[model samples]
Target chain A: MASPEIEELTQALSRLPGLGPRSARRAVLHLLKKRESALEPLLRALDAVNERLVTCSLCGNVDTVDPCGICADPRRDARALCVVEDVADLWALDKSRLFPGRFHVLGGRLSALEGVRPEDLSIDALVARVEAGGIDEVVLAMNATLEGQTTAHYLAERLERFPVRLTQLAHGVPVGGELDYLDEGTLAQALRARRPLG
Target chain B: MASPEIEELTQALSRLPGLGPRSARRAVLHLLKKRESALEPLLRALDAVNERLVTCSLCGNVDTVDPCGICADPRRDARALCVVEDVADLWALDKSRLFPGRFHVLGGRLSALEGVRPEDLSIDALVARVEAGGIDEVVLAMNATLEGQTTAHYLAERLERFPVRLTQLAHGVPVGGELDYLDEGTLAQALRARRPLG
Candidate 1:
């Protein structure tokens, strides 16, 4: 039989997203083969992340430091704060290079079926940031899913006490989207938000 | 944008066999979410592997202890040794729990296209193990692929001078395999090695 250590490593690896038992075994084998190049560095990186990463005090974003790089950067528009569903969504928006503002991460969207509540997310921290002033606009950059919409509506109502103009990602045909392939909801949104010709 | 640590961790995770950039990011986020339960333990496991794991001098298996557990076990049938193409293969066979004998891991198969020579693999070590005596039979448990076949043939010829008996895995339709779905070569082998009806 395979040694318990090998089995343990494989089981741990299988817990990763997109990896199953078979694939985990393969990955473990690959790591053993390239122990110096892949495995050791990965171990070091994991240790660094586990030891150094912390939640940003201002926006609840995962950061190596207290405020995280984005929240701490002075060059970003402090007046515009983009709210996202998760750190992954925040990273995706940042990768697009479209939004040039700070971000606030709400741990997860509201899901009552799964027994998730508003208090389960970082909504209180977000509200605290908005109440502190200086933000001229709050952009709700949550996903288009039902839970995301519910979370967005809830946030819009909650942030009404502040003097900031609240907005959300417009529902319309995405960039490079084809009309025929577009869903009915997107088509309707595009028609409703249609602008006058120049 | 993600911190340098997050980016580095993501990049390192993406190098794993089944994980890609997007999945790696998700994995990093997952680890961050379950730092105490999952991430810390994983880091500890990797550290242990990095600091403790070594190649078994006798069997070429990756082990936390020298000579590995299987090689050190005195109860195993040393007379019947199973030889495999890689540590992955060895682990797979070990998982099957069918073979009760010891093992010899051939780091990789002899591949001509990849410029992999016999000397590049652990074939020499295997020969040395066989020549040391007490091993009455050597089961060539290599893959059925071209390179695996070439390596097996080479080993078979090389071991002809030794007193130990050599045997390769039997070829036929796999268990639960349908004859119509089976390949011609497998069908041919099944016909050639047909046994009397029970």
Candidate 2:
């Protein structure tokens, strides 16, 4: 089909989150077509991130700077530390602009079956950060999945030595989610955490 | 939140097919995680493709070499020419290894509504390619869409001046397509082109 180089490119692109073989080929062709505006800039950008980007020592977030955007922001409440399962979750919360605080990425959850233990995550470092003081609250903003809950519960017990207040995202139907489509667990939680309506 | 460089990379990657903003960010993170295996190799491959690859003068196919792999292959059937709408189509046909012929990329189809005239495509070069040589057959392997059909018809009429046989791909229920899901036009075509069991 294509040359060895193009095939190599397609192979690399297929490793990405959503792209597969066919879509990788399409992406290569597209990049070739839009060489200057899209491809060149993307190449430069990828190289830049690869060369300069490093994880923030304080929060485990990837950034060019040492402290990352969130950790460095003075306006964000340092006392309100948001704990997430991964970097993607951190970004999602950041995009919403609701959580006016810093973050500590666990790297992953405590999945014993998958061999992901507390040591494998940033639990030690996070506890140390909380133990160092000044953090008034710890937001356990993990997904409502089994792994997420397990990780959250484990962290709560581990961080019991610290005085930080712990909280988790409410389990319920998503904002745009219909009740019919929601699972029974979410319905039950929503019912239990019933709030007064306007 | 991520730094400026990660954001820039995400923005660029989001432009690629199959990647939105969130997926692009995920891809960046994945690359960061698999820096040695996926990221570095991809960067090198992309740069290699950008620096070296060029379109074949004879066939309009993209390749690192001057005449492209297909055009340069001595064993290929030079007399059998397959015409397609774009490089992507050419690659698709080539990947199957079913078409042992050379290719001529039309760049695009004739769209009167979009003001894409015959000149807008590489129709002149294609006509010249057919007019000059000993091409036994011309396979119009365009898509089974209105635009593809229109271009094929126009090319057929134009190539009527030459002594080559012009053909098109058969329209039928795809190999894995279910009978229940097939439309009337396809069903009629399949019935009309039905082959007897040997």
For DockQ, the strongest prediction is 2
Task: List, residue by residue over A1-198, the lDDT tens digit for candidate 2.
Answer: 788889889999998989999899889988987889888998999899889988889988887788887788999888899999888888889988999989999998888789998888899899889999999999998888899999899999998777878888887778999999989999999999999997
A1-198 per-residue lDDT for model 1 (tens digits): 556667778888888878899998888888888988899889888988988899888887888788788888889999999999998898889888889889999988999898889999999989998998999999998899999999999999999989999999888888999999998988998999999999
* CAPRI level of candidate 2: medium
Give the best candidate by lDDT: 2
Interface RMSD, every prediction, one decimal place: 1.3, 1.5
Q: Residues B21-128, candidate 2, lDDT per residue (tens digit)?
A: 988988988998788998899899899889989988888888988888789899999999999998999987888999988999998888888999999888999999
Assess chain B of each prediction and give its TM-score: 0.90, 0.88
Per-model TM values vs. the true structure:
0.91, 0.89
List ranges where model 1 is wrong by over 4 Å. Answer: A177-188, A196-198, B178-184
